[model samples]
Target chain A: MLKINDLHASVEDKAILRGINLHVKPGEVHAIMGPNGSGKSTLASVVAGKEEYEVQSGEILLDGENIDELSAEERAHKGVFLSFQYPVEIPGVSVTNFMKTAINETRKAQGLKEMPANEMLKMIRQKSELLEIDRKFLSRSLNEGFSGGEKKRNEIFQMAMLEPKLAILDETDSGLDIDALRIVANGVNKLKSEDNAVIVITHYQRLLDYIVPDFVHVLYEGRIVKSGTKELAHELEAKGYDWIKEEVGV
Target chain B: MSKYTEDDLREELKTKEYEYGFYTDIESETFPVGLNEDIVRAISKKKEEPEWMTEWRLEAFRSWQEMIEPEWANVHYEKPDFQAISYYSAPNSKPKYDSLDEVDPELLATFEKLGISLDEQKKLAGVAMDVVVDSVSVATTFKKTLAEKGIIFCSISEAIQEHPELVKKYIGTVVPQKDNFYAALNSAVFSDGSFCYIPKGVRCPMELSTYFRINQAGTGQFERTLVIADEGSYVSYLEGCTAPSRDENQLHAAVVELIALDDAEIKYSTVQNWFPGDADGKGGVFNFVTKRGLCEKNAKISWTQVETGSAVTWKYPSCVLKGDNSVGEFYSIAVTNNYQQADTGTKMVHLGNNTKSTIISKGISAGKSQNSYRGLVQVSSRAENARNFSQCDSLLMGNLCGAHTFPYIEANNKTAKIEHEATTSKIGEDQIFYCNQRGIDTEKAIALIVNGFSKEVLNKLPMEFAVEAQKLLEISLEGSVG
Candidate 1:
């Protein structure tokens, strides 16, 4: 469902992703693990079409179509979603209003009429219950005063609302407590389907316990140095990334 | 970003004239471009003012001549060459028609071009309008119906002749003729504007509105409006203005005064969209206005404005809390894009004990525009237990634009309590990307963010005007997104 060939991206002349090659088929979950500054988050940002990053040479294809020229919004309409590392606080805009606008905008791009208010409210309530989010959170300003755990959970809740074809979770477990982490992972696990793909980018293997991945890739210095199965996550969690850096002579 | 020299910056500031600039070829009765005792008397005579009104105008004119233009506002513009501009320029043809159908087609066309629906069939229900073209009130609607409720609504000129005693008692009472430079100039040669008076113990039956359009070139429009709410009465007055896009900057100096007596309430709202100069900031309207209201004891007055146009706007619609337990409120959202510049806010003067006031100002600056909020809150010695709360926020779209806040607070009574909070922020790229990732384009994202910034102020407007103001904010910020 997604392919990245020799993805070389840089921001402000500083290369962050150097020749990254990856692919994921439908219904599969892939996890990318790396230490801080190892380009794990950069990889997710590059895939989401952030304009600040310069893709010097490479092409990204989604569903066999070149999408490098598409805007972030166009990519979203094409069912590509990114769970932000740090959710933005948009004051005075209620969460429900924001979600409704996003949902209607995506539907409009797909040439579909807006969902009825009652139906939309019902879906939101169901999703909130699944994500363990209180109904009052839906009426407050978008993440205005939410804690770190609340923010991460809200990101997962938004992911559920958007229902993108390819969901890229960037460090979704970084600030979550044990229970919040389980709930977020459970939400992502429940969203899995045969025609969709999920890529979990994290530094810790603890999250892998909840939403197990079919494949794990170890990234270092902007390159994917090793690829293996779910056991690879446990190996790295025990040995840590420094052993790999020493083995790779970096 | 490319480094530009001084010449490049100068070129960047060159502005173009936008769409509203088609001038009509109608003849007009204009006074010479100067002011004197005779000119003031002539204007009064032209309107057939009552003897007492003529004397009152003369007194204001003399006081205005003695006052100096205030230099306190955070605005920079060449002092207007008042002696070189025509102040009273009315259309030559007078409407002799006994009904709205007989109003001149040319004048009606002007209003239509300004996007104001004047046709009887298109008029909104429960909305009465007074149309002011150039410097004269051409036609007033729902006059008979309004009169049936003892509500007197007409042009200032007509009020002077019809209700001279009322006009004489209230003119310049709230905002004196010598209040400021522009106010003094307006007082010296003010032409005509709307005059509304809700009788004692009566609530106005409809929304009273006045539309002011500047149609002639090189003519400076000085309009004076006065609205009075008698004891226990209630009224809502709305003012909407538009001017033809002009390459040469046109001067508009208007003064509006409002008075709410004991147990009365007044709500005044304005949607000011004068011609903002082109992208380069070459030609537009220079709007210098003074608007103020007085709330007597137990009375309330509120001012709500959405100012999105004008090349340079310098106006402060203030309120004077003179009666105990009276309330004053100001809600404004001012947007300046391109080369437009605006320095506007309100003043709250508390003279009676237990008075209260609230001010909320939101400014959005994009492109190379400059927006500032300058406000003052003064509590008198006798205003014990008075309270005021002020919040001013600015949103900058890019680094090129500027946003500033200048708040002046003075408390003389030990029991007075005042609180102020202000914040300035740029629309970060991450926020834009977050919205874009939700299938919202950059333009729509910018609009959404701006609307959110102005939600507090916009929500204060009347229902219909709030929607109109929201649409205006969207259109005004076109191409402002990165």
Candidate 2:
């Protein structure tokens, strides 16, 4: 469902993703584990089409179509979603209004009519209940004055609302408590299907316990140095990233 | 003095007409373009004012001649050649309008172009309008309905004729003729604007509005509006203005004075969309207006404005808190695009003890235009326990535009608590990308963010005008963002 070939990206002339090659098929969960400066978040941002990252040379394909030249909004219309590490706080913009605009915009781009307000509200209610988010939370400004855990949960709530084809969770468990993390993982796990995929980018393997991945890739210096099964997450969690660094010889 | 014997030398001359040289052929009576003692006398004589009123006009004219144009605003334009412009241009039509059916079609057509149908304006449930076409008030709707509640709504000229005592007493009390240059100019040669008086203990049943349109070329619009809310009375007044597109800069110097007596409340709102100059800045309206309100003991006054158009706008709607426990507020969203320049804000003067004031200003600048918010908050020594809060925010659409904020706070009373906050920021690419990533396009994203930036001020607008203001903001910022 997704492919990245020799993805070389930089910001302000400083290369962040030197050479990255990865692929994921449908119905599979892939976890990328790395240290703080291993370009894990940069990889997610590049895939989401952030303008600040300069793609010196690369090709990103989603469902066999080149997406590197597409705009962020166009990519979003193609069912690409990014769960931000720090959600932006848009003041005075109600969550329901923001979500409706986003949902309708995506649907319109996909050649569908706008959803009725009542139906949208009903859908939001059902999703809120499923995600355990309070109904009043949808009326408040998006992420304004929300707690750290609430922000992460809101990110997951948005993911559920958009129902993107490829969901990239960038450190979604960083600020979440264990229970919040479990709830977030549960929400992601519920949305998984045979035609969609999930890429969980994290520094800790604790989140891997809730949403187990089919494959684990150890990223070191912007390159995927090793790949294995779910046991690789446990091995890294026990011995830390030093083992990978020693094995890769810098 | 020409050539030889039967030859004569003739020099052909052309008048430097208005840069906005559009003319509508409506039969009108106009005073010649010049200013002197006789012109003031003629204006007073034409209105058939009392002796004291004539003396007042003369005093204002003399004071105006002595004072020079103010250079304090952040606008740059040649001083208007006041002596070379006509101050009064009234339609030559008769003043006998027994009913709405007797109104002139030409005047009605002008209103039609302004999108104001007289019938629709009359049928609007809670709105009363006084239409000022050119230099005179043509018709005032809902006068009888308003009069039943002891609320007096009429033209300033009619008020001078019917309610002369009230007009003579409080006409210039709030905004004295010598208050400023434009005020003095308006005082010297002011034409007709609306006059609204809410009686004591009466809450006005409807929103009082006045529409001022300038249709004649080479004519300066000097409208003087006075709204007084008596003790315990409440009123909301709205003013909207527009002008035909012109290349010669048309001069518009208006003075609006609002007075709120003890325990009274007054809310004044304006949606000004005067013709901004062409994209090349060839011509537009030069709006130098003076609007001020005075709040007596326990009275409150609020000024809300959505300014979208004007070539060079220089105005500050202010308030004077003279009564104890009085409150003043100003909420504004001033946008300038395509060579439009505006230097506008508000001032609050706390003169009585325990007075309070709040100011929120949002300025959006685009397309090499310059927008500024200049305000002042002053607390006199007698105003103990005075409080004030001011927030001014500016959003720049491009690198070429400019946004500036200048706030001056003067506190002679040690007990006064005043706080001022301002921020200037350009719409960053990251913020835009975030919105775009959500499937919202660039234009809608810009509108959403701009709306959010001005939400604080927009919330203060009246319900009907809020939607209009939002649409205006969106249209004004078109082609602003890349």
Candidate 3:
């Protein structure tokens, strides 16, 4: 579903991702765990086509097509999604209106008409029910004074609305409590299918417990230093990243 | 990230042209360029005014000659050459129109181009429209419907001749002559505007709107709008102005006076889109307007304005709460882009006990423009328990633009409760990236954020006008970001 070859990226001439190579097929979940400032979020943002990070020497492919030149919005239209670590607050714009605009813009880019109002409302109702979001929550300003859990849940709500082909959950569990973590992980588990993929980038194995991954990779200083199955997460969580740092001869 | 920096956004902002820049082709009777007592008298005489009206203009002209233009506003412009401007210009033929069909086709086409088809407006919008072109009221629609309800809606010239008692009773009462430099000039040489009077205990059946268009070249448009709501009455009046593109700046000095009698309520809204200069700030309109309303006992007055165009704008819509328990409200959204400069806000004076006022102002500055909010809240000694709440916010796009706030409060009565809040923020690139990642482009992203910022003020507008204001906000900021 997605491929990255020698993905070297930087922001403002400060190198972040030195070299990254990854391949993920449909119907699979991949977990990329790293210490703080190890380029995990940078990978997600670069793949999402954030213009601030220049792809110094790399190529990203979606369905065998090079997407290095695509803009963030274009990537969005092509079914790429990024759950932000900290959602931007847009006051006075309701969540429903924001989703409507996002959906309509994507449809417009794909040469499709806007979804009928009734269908959009029905979808909103169904999706909010799936995520256990209150009806009134959909009418409030987009993340403007929302609690941390609400913001993460709202990000997932948007992800559900877009139904992207490749979803990158960047630090999605950073601010979630136990209950919120369960709900969010449950939502992500239900959204998984054979035709889409999810890349969960996190700093701990706590989130992996709820949404089990097919494979785990340890990112150190921008490169993947270790790759293994789900048990690798528990092992790393038990021993901490200091062992990995020693193994990498840092 | 760095590829689409603030410099790129500023460059893109310079390419946007004024949307309503097309000039209308119509022959006009233009007065020669100059300003003097003789010119002022000629304007009054040309309107066929009564003796008192003519004398009133002469007096205003005398006061104007003695007063110098004030430089206190947070704006700098090459002072306009008042003597080089033609004070009066009107369509050569002013034919009495019994129906919309009898109105001149050229004038109707002009309005149609402005998206205000009088025929459509009369049938659909249920709005009584007084269309003023280059200083003369060309067409007045729905007069019969308004007249049936004992509502007096007509051109100021017509009102002077037909309802002199009402016109004489209220004209210049709120913003009297010598109130300011521009007010004196407008009072001296004002040609024509709408005059509406809601009868006692009558609610106006429809919105009273006046659309002012400056079609002729080189002529200054000075319009005087007077609206009076009698005791126990209510009215909503709308004023919209647009000017054709010109290479040299044109002057527009207007005076608006509103009176809400005891137990009456008046809502006045203005969507001013005069010609803003080109990217290099070579031409546009100098909009200097004086708008004030007086609220009597138990009366309420509200001013809502969405100003988006003009090279230099100096306007303050104010309210004088004269009667006990009266209310005053001002909601404004001022947008400046490309070299535009706007210094606009409101003044609320509480002179009676328990008078309350609310002011909400949102200023958006893009490109190299400068937008400022200057407001004053005065609580007189007699105004016991007077309350005022004010919020002023500014949003800037690109690093070259500027936003400023100057709020003045004078509380003579210690019991007065006054609160003010203000904030300034830039349109962060992160906000844009967020929207972009959601499949919205940079342009749409900016528009979305701007609309969100202005939602509070826009909500105060009438439904139809609110939609128009939203669209105007988008158009004003289009291409303002890369």
Candidate 4:
């Protein structure tokens, strides 16, 4: 579903991701875990085509097509979604209206008619129910004064609405409590399909417990140091990232 | 339901022509450059004003000659060459027309393009419209219906002729002739505007409105609007303006005065879309207006405005709470894009006991424009228990634009309760990316963000004009700096 070869990215003059090569086939869930200063989040951001980051030397292919030149919005129209850790607070724009704009814009880009109002409403109702989001919550201003859990849940709600082919959950679990984590994890699990993929980037293996991954890669010093199956997450959770840092030997 | 492609929309936005840019091809009786008592007398005589009206205009002309233009606003522009602008220009046609069909084809076409044709407006049910072209009113609709209800709605010129007593008693009563330099000039040589009067205990069943169109090349448009809500009456008046595209800046100095007598209520709304100059800030309207309302015992006055046009806008619609338990409110959203500049707000003067006032102002600055909100809230010594609440928020779209606020509050009565809150926010790149990541383009995202930022003030507009104001905000900031 997604392929990155020698992904060397930098923001400003500082190199973040030195050399990253990763491949995720369809229906695969990959978890990338690293300590605070590692390039885990940077990898997610680079793949999503954030313009601030310079892809110094990299090739990102989506379905075998080079997407390096695509804009963030274009990437989104091509079924790439990023669930921001900190969703923007757009006061006075209701969540429903924001989603409407997003949906219509994507449909417009794909040369499709706008979803009928009733269908959109029904979709919102069914999807929001999947996340246990109150109906009134959908009418409030988009993330303005929303609690941290609500913001993360809203991010997942948007992810559900867009139903992207490749979803990047960048630190989506950092601000969630136990119940919110369960709800968000459940929502993502229900949306997973053989034709879709999710790249989970987290500091701790805590989120991996709720949304188990098919594979785990230990990222340290801007490169993947180890790759293993789901037990690697349990091992990292039991021990710590210190073992990997020591193994990399600075 | 939609046929436009994104390319077509982009092409249309690229042209960005002033939608109301067509100039009427009519022979106009215009005055030559210069100003004096003779010019004022000529304008008054042209309107066939009553003797008292003529005398008041002469007095204003004398006062204007002695007044120096104030320079305290936060806008930068070359001072206009007042001596070079024609003080009066009116279409060479008769005053009264029986129906919209009788109006000149060219003049009617102008309104049609503006989407406010008399027939369309009459179909709007309860809106009485006075269409002012250049410096004279060419169409007045729903006058008969309004008159039958003891409501006076007509051109100021016609009001001076038919309801001279009301005009004489109310003109300059709220915003006096010498209130400011522009007000003095408008009082002196003002040509025509809408005049509305609601009789005692009578609630006007319609929205009294006027559409001022500046068509001539170099003629200045001086309009005077007066609305009076007599004792225990209620009225809501709305006015909007547009000007033909001109390379050289045109001057528009208008004065609006409103009076709400005892137990009366008056609501005034304005959607000002004067021609903002070209991208380089070459030609546009220099809009300098003075608007104020006087509230009597237990009366209420509210001013709601959406200012999205003009090369340079300097207007402060204010309220004077003069009687016990009176109230005042100001809700505004001012947008300045390109090289446009605006320094507008309101003044609430509390002179009566327990008088209350509320102010909400939102300013959006894009491109290299500058937007400022300058307001004053004053509580006099005897205004015990007077209360005022003010909120002013500014949203900056690009790094190049500027937003400023200057709120002056003076409380002489120790018992007065005054509170103010203000915030300045930037349209962060992350915010834009958030929308982009959701598949919305930059243009549509910006329009959504801006509309959201000003929703509070936009909500205060009349039902029909809110949609127009929202569109104006988008068009004004279409191709912004960022």
True contacts kept of each: 0.62, 0.48, 0.68, 0.68
- Candidate 2 Cα misplacement greater than 4 A, ranges: A12-19, A56-58, A111-113, A242-250, B1-30, B44-54, B91-118, B480-482
The residue ranges of model 4 lying beyond 4 angstroms of the native Cα positions read B1-19, B480-482
Candidate DockQ values, in order, are 0.51, 0.24, 0.68, 0.45
Give the per-residue lDDT of model 1 (tens digit) for B87-142.
68998877645676777677767666666766642367667888888998887888
Model 3 off-target regions past 4 Å?
B480-482
Judging by lDDT, tell me the better candidate of 1 and 4.
4
Enumerate residue pairs that collide in model 4.
Answer: none
Tens digit per residue, CA lDDT, model 4, B329-400 = 999999887789999999999999999999999998877789999999999999999999999999987566
Q: Model 1: what TM-score?
A: 0.94
Clash list (residue pairs), candidate 2: B18-B248, B19-B247, B19-B248, B20-B246, B20-B247, B20-B248
Quote model 3's TM-score for chain B: 0.98
Q: What is the lDDT of candidate 3?
A: 0.91
lDDT of 1 by residue, A1-250 (tens): 9999999989889998899999999999999999899898888877888777778898899999988888788899999999988999888888888899899989998999998999999999989998878999888888889988888888888899999999999999998899989989999998899989999999899999999999999999999988999999999999998888997898
Chain B of candidate 4 achieves a TM-score of 0.95
| Candidate 2 residue-pair clash tally | 6
All candidates' chain B TM-scores are 0.93, 0.92, 0.98, 0.95
Q: Output the number of the lDDT-best candidate.
A: 3
Q: For every model shown, what is its TM-score relative to the native structure?
A: 0.94, 0.90, 0.99, 0.95
Candidate 1, which segments miss by more than 4 Å at Cα? A113-119, B1-21, B24-27, B96-100, B120-125, B480-482
Question: Candidate 1 or 4, higher DockQ?
Answer: 1
